[model samples]
Target: MSECCCGEKDIYLPELATITRMQHMNETELFLHLELDSGKELGHMPGQFVEVSVAGIGEAPISNTSSPTKSGFDLVVRKIGRVTNAIHAMKEGDKLGIRGPLGHGYPLEDMKGKDLVFICGGIGLVPQRSLINYVLDKPEDFGKVAILFGAASFEQRLYQDQLARWAQNDKVQLLETIDKPHPEWSGNVGVVTTIMNQIDIDLANAISLICGPPIMYKFVIMSLEQANVSNENIFVNLERRMKCGVGKCGHCQINHHYACQSGPVFRYSDLSDIPEAI
Candidate 1:
């Protein structure tokens, strides 16, 4: 056991954490909660991500879905790649390599007292959930919160239970939509951007965060600007094939920025000059 930057003592390098629990969000999706052997905390910021590795497989950049205030962090893994598939097969008590609650996390300091619009698409909610839950913990530190989420289908919705709880919160408004709807569905059906139409833009003192696939950003950004949110006030979370979890890896490079370090989370202003960011 070693220690993490969070000051928890005897935490192993990078750290050796055990799989405390696992939940299947759907047929091809899973969420894992790893408990550190030293009983130390990951001490991560909301929107900060982690680098997880499975022995004999490989590593993947994953977001910290749990709030920083919580004892252990949560990672939502979708079985689209080899490492994730390996992760999905593991159960409680499995050992894995952990490096980081790395990269620059969300800007919680700037968000204080500002109305927030959380526009998420697909598994975008997985990363945004970190900030969303953090805001809920200290509800008074922020203003109104609206979550606009979209997925390919209902079955693809991540964290359905948590999203429902957000919708139930008086301080939060969770608006969700699907690209294609089933006969049993009745909510917004076009896209996540459509929910933006229902918002009363409070751009003078509001901030917006957008995350999802690359294609989702083009339309979402255009819609946010129309609602009067400034380029500086809007943030986007970019996904890339990250390695090293630090800037050393070239895999997540966006012009001069390294998505793994400069961010898996970024403000439009920081990346406005980076052509590949969008």
Candidate 2:
């Protein structure tokens, strides 16, 4: 009923975003697409996340995989804890609170004209998909592009339809693998790091952005280094508990850096000294 900071009138303050779509992508993963009455675009950059709240149940930080250009956005969530379990029970059109498209996103400006290599693992592919689809929309703005994705198993792959389209792009080199294989799967079978063996990188001109669990980041960075990519050119997305999307909540801090504000996306150069980043 009042004017908002952006000079907009009567925005829904995020609490009114009725869940328009909700589905289970896997046994452990749930996808929620909310349509807020705010009528304001998320206006977020790729690699960012949002804080979702379900009344008395509490809240959790979930990465946004759908590009900002997409109608609303998509959150690929894996329920491992309490708050997530409540989120899983929600049905379409259920109301929930959403704050942000928070945290720094990928270095898209720096990516212009650079050969971009995306190394995504597990649910890590969610954030990577945002940057991937964005880059594809502006093809000539980049140089040689490649995507190397790995997951725990064939059954856990996310966004299989879009992955197929990316594979069809002549200018993009797409390679995907899984640690364990299924009978119908014909792709490589090993950790995602194994795909590194199939591509040649000009470390001087190449940049890699990776997302995954702690162990995956450890080994992937090692592989990228062996391929000669400088530590400075490597970026990562760090996820920690986040309550407030803003800096007020102490949950997302890692020492002096607030993962909600300063990251969720960060270059290795800035993180090289932060052991917790591992």
Candidate 3:
């Protein structure tokens, strides 16, 4: 295989990566830690995803759940299809093929010194965690940080220990809720949007990042607009639309824009002309 000038192989070819750890976060989700066999870091920024493959099972695009500042990369895979099912069956010492740190990432440089409000629902938190950790790791580079997460129920929550830690950290403010009430849960009991009322940021100087089910976008954007947060200051992660990490497949197209190429992350204002996007 011919190597690119960056010393990596062709983007279409999968490089071998070894799984270093695996943890079951819930009944359907598996958290994995991997390192490239080439002994080099994945060198991914927050919000980029990688294409993972098993020998006969096919490939799927999975987001990097960890920040680039960390030693190894992480992914939280939901057992929904053949590729992910095969991934869940893997063990700690197992190996898989990785193709990228693909797609455009969040605009971290522009976000410096601006307050951030992260809103996530269900498994959408997987990709958002990357940027969350990146900002937390360098608190002085940013302003206030707030995270609001909603799950179907308390039992469906991912990264319980980390959530607990973020809750305890004075530098971060976290609010978690569920769609419906559970006997063991005494915290907020409502959809993710319900907690927006509790946010206390300076809307004029704040930026909001949202990632969740397709259905949640409209209402969340409405809530943000009602609160007077500018569309230019709002961003969304559409990583779920990615099929082929490279733009050739056309699966992630929204009108003339290729989400995988131009963005898995986009400023809300830029998508105004693309009705199908959101």
Estimate TM-scores for all models. Answer: 0.93, 0.90, 0.95
Per-residue C-alpha lDDT of model 3 across residues 1-278, encoded as one tens digit per residue:
65467876566889999999999999999999999999999999999889999989999988899999999899999999999999999999999999889999899998999999999999989999999999999989999889999999888988899898888877788989999899899999999999988887876579999999899899999999998899999999885456778898888898888888888888999999999887
Ranking by lDDT: 3, 1, 2
Task: Indicate whether candidate 1 or candidate 3 has the larger TM-score.
Answer: 3
| Candidate 1: clashing pairs of residues | 1-10, 2-10, 2-11, 2-12
C-alpha RMSD values across all candidates: 3.8, 3.4, 2.4
Candidate 1 lDDT over residue span 1-278, tens digit each: 64466865432246778998999999887988988777888889988888888877878888888998788888898898998989988988897788887888888888999899889988888899899888999988999898889999978888878977887899987788898978877988988888888865475468999898889998999987787778889889998878777777588888888887788878888877788888
**TM-score for candidate 1, residues paired by index:** 0.93
Off by over 4 Å in 1: 1-13
Which candidate number would show the highest lDDT if scored against the true structure?
3
Model 3: lDDT equals: 0.90
lDDT of 1: 0.84
Cα lDDT listed for each candidate: 0.84, 0.82, 0.90
Q: Which residue pairs collide, candidate 3?
A: none
